[model samples]
Target: MCPPYFSSNTYFSNAIKITTFLAQSYTTMIRATFLSILVLFGVNLLAQNTPYPTRFELSGGTETPTYAEGIAYYQKLDADFKTIKLFTKGPTDSGKPLHLALFSKTRNFDLKKLRAEGKAIFFINNAIHPGEPDGVDASMMLLRDLALHPERYPALDSVVVAIIPFYNIGGALNRSSTSRVDQNGPKEHGFRGNARNYDLNRDFIKADTRNARSFAAIFQELDPDFFIDTHVSNGADYQHVMTFCYTQEDKLGGVLGEFHQKTVLPSLYAHMQAKGFPSTPYVNAWGQTPDKGWTQFPDWPRYSTGYAALFHTIGIMSETHMLKPYEQRVKATYALLEGSLKLLGEKRAQWLALRRQTKAAVATQTDFPITWKVNREKFSETEFLGYEAEYPLSKVSGLKRLQYNHDKPFRKIVPFYDHYEAENVVKKPRFYVIPQAWFNVIDLLKTNQIQMQTIKRDSSIEVTQYKIDNLQTSRNVYEGHFFHNNLEVKAEKQIMAFAAGDVLVPVDQWRNRYIVETLEPKAQDSFFRWNFFDAILQEKGGFSSYHFEEMAAKLLEKSPELRQKLEEKKRSDEKFAQSGDAQLNFIYENSIFAEKEYRRYPIYRVE
Candidate 1:
């Protein structure tokens, strides 16, 4: 370096200058890097401005339970009063396993001790419908409040409160923000029926849950003392959040007494009233059971409350109005749970008294003759063939335009009497009234989204042909009606609960004696070879060819056409499909019914 002799040459001078420039550049970059980090910190601080923060960590459930904030909150609850079981896989649907968090004070709270101290309370859950998301939301709120403020939920020591925030995991995921972004359905709608599109509520009694298995699992494992199912009602039908107990006539529901009334319904009612929310109640008796939950479906066996009530346990089902906002529904749910817990906590001398009385009444209960509504509005009168024509969607549109200048909502049915003709025109691609409404009363069909025909019999707006068209189905809806020649019954209730397989319904025996139902049975063209009197005398739950001859004898008394419809089998366009989409590869041919009679239940009052 000494030999190079300093900056004597210009080339040496330039090299020295370049080295100095490079050093300065390196120093500047280091300073710039520090400045960038400072800006980033400030931006993040601005993003999180709330004092009490919420982070949507998992993305689909709640705004809580994220790694950054809610973990500490949940941890606080776990540390204070409970054990958190990490369901590495909460539940599975199709092939995917879902992750869930189950928080309970497990061993800390002993059921035996609670029972010894007379302070045990079980939960009845409702609110699995994703569209009516309040029950689940309220569940989380209740969990947090109880977990954080144990003193508030003092009953936790005595009561084993289970928080099943999401009953239908898949449905909830679809409705949540993360999943809603790409929910798959008709037109990408957020409303998705399970994997198979059947309402879980209706799928209870039947065991056809190829769509989901959790319903069956929970039913067997937790025979909870009280059951609650939360749902939403159409805006037109309900005014506010309502409670349904077995109707007054059904006051015979022995165990669901004052405790149910005071602890569950009153609390929910009072809570919502304080919130200025509107509500209604189903007739105390009629709506309290799954069999009477509007229309019956095969899934009565799996209904949480239905199972509870059938076993003489307490049950409560709450329905919020659709018109209410999402936040309001959530608030309502919070109020419901809070009220329920408070009621449960309060000592009930009346409940114990009622329980003793209920047991006594049940022991002596009788099968008082079941004279049902054989002549409900649908069955009040039979208009002879050619008396009225079926109404289709197109005609209803025309009526709407003519009457309200299309200002009225697209109604499923119409106004005016003898609009019956317009209501039952089966000629159109979409007929709403005559066939749909008529078929259900006879217990001949099970369908959804049917067209309604307008009937002006009652002030109730449900008289719309479009609305009446949907006769809610039951597990054995037709068991009461199959009193024809081909189908036979002998002093027993026989029903084919599940769909008849291709070789099931014993077509040949049923073919000649009774009205054989086909894909498209001709309107009013029916023949029968049975008599009504003998059919009634037989006392079979399902009808048979023997009953058909009995019904024929009834033709001599009142209704003549009833006898003729036997032996009337026509090709039908109406098809029953297990999968809602109708894309599932299944043959709807030769569904033969077993001659087997449905088992009869001698229904007796519990109290």
Candidate 2:
């Protein structure tokens, strides 16, 4: 039999014949089918029209769309295109829902099912810092082009593009012309902070904002193979319009990292160069010009690319130069996105295999690096096209200020300190036990889709515990946290009793790196450093000098070992011998009078 005709014009005739044969019994069913077909036909007709111009384009790249307008445009695309789908994933700090736009070749929106079918997922995050909206406009054009001209880009067949249209909705809504003082154009743009004035970029690991938690959910759900967080550069200017900060190779650490550094990154740079938009590594030159070499931006877990690296995803931050015209910046970002999508599509098989291998290796890996430092001895040379540095006196201050002489552009090879060595390494534990009291930490872990189990009943488990021996906290608040660093943790084997409902996170999983990095106290962006476990640093109880002095003497008399240690400390240190309170407090502390919870990191490790 011939296939049943569902075309709008043919559907009515076919439906009438069937209804007449069934004597009006099939009237309702035929009407419903006809209406559905008409709706679909209308959508197809709408899709054939000329693509809608974004606010950026309509304004000649002088302005970006408001949060509402950006969403409305995506909604329109969702209505018109069968391959495009828009989903409201979760809530943001702005009281608005976070929207994820998906463009699929098979029209399949299910990410897991698409992965099974061998389609690579490429996630593009835009407007994370609303002040830098290059990615915001570029992604809109990129996704729209993919939907309107699917055949023009054969990459769609093997790659699915997902985009977070406007990440910082609050900031996007809080638009102003004066927010980014350094930015060259875009007459108006969003602010840098969200509604709560939090920099969303640094909240990835801590997840202090609702937007971050929601992002965690979306990121874990997609588990993209290739990711890009778009932004505009804020540092020293150069001839290059676009620059990139890929996840540090040694930190990403594996065959996957090797493939990304040696194969994928070169292809992307070469592709962009061929397209007439020469690129360079992100100019991390702070307080200096590009003539001198600079180190790669170390993307610790707090940043977007760094978070993606924890999952073994190849991630890059496309940073367009802020001094460039808004139009040029947007176009450069668009070109980079196009090049990334094409490369990811072409190398999907090899990339996917590397990711799989990396994940498997992480699961069984023993030692994981928790901290990294740049290897200043090692560097790579790259052609840096930049303006000459000139220390011209400031007109207002009459003081010498470093400035780039844009009139004198030069091309010369500069050393790129792209190599990093692990400064602190940690042995992975079999499992990490988190007390129920630390609900916030546990919630974030769960949000990241880390496999966890709960203790059925109160039980004592022999585990390794960390005592926060020493650490320096930042005097100034950083991203709403008195961030801690220079950590010195002392590990000891002990029997810890965990109550019912306490979380047990295993290390033998795909999220091993994330588990280790966050749980290990020395990790640069660990929860302890973010002040999640700050309560442990303060002693809950203290001894009175007068009352404890007599008790200290008796305790010292009762314990010869304790007495000898106190005597040795006094002999070794003059200050200890002079301060009576210090002697009393030291004796009390070394005795059993001090609180066990004090200075004890709550997260326990199973070896």
**Top candidate when judged by TM-score against the true structure:** 2
TM-score for each model: 0.46, 0.91
Q: For each candidate, what is the lDDT?
A: 0.35, 0.87
Model 1 error, position 449 (Å): 36
Give lDDT tens digits, candidate 1, residues 231-348: 6554222224443432211322435444554455556566656766534353222222211213211112234454344334566566554444454555565666666665555543
**Model 2, 498: alpha-carbon shift in Å?**
1.8
**Candidate 2: stretches off by over 4 Å:** 1-50
Candidate 2, after superposition: displacement of residue 390 in Å?
A: 1.6
lDDT of 2 by residue, 1-607 (tens): 1112222221001334433333333544564465446446542222111235577765656778888889999998898888999999899989998999999978889898999999999999999999999999888888877876677788899999999999999999999899889999798889989989999999999998999999999999999999999999998979999999889888888898899899988999999898778999999988777788799999988999999999999899999999899988998998899999999989999999889888888899999999999999999988899998888899989999888887999999999999999999888988999999999999999899999999999999999999888999999988899999899989999998889999999899989989999989899889889999988888888988878878888998899999999999999999999999888888878988888999999999999
Per-candidate count of clashing residue pairs (backbone under 3 Å)? 77, 0
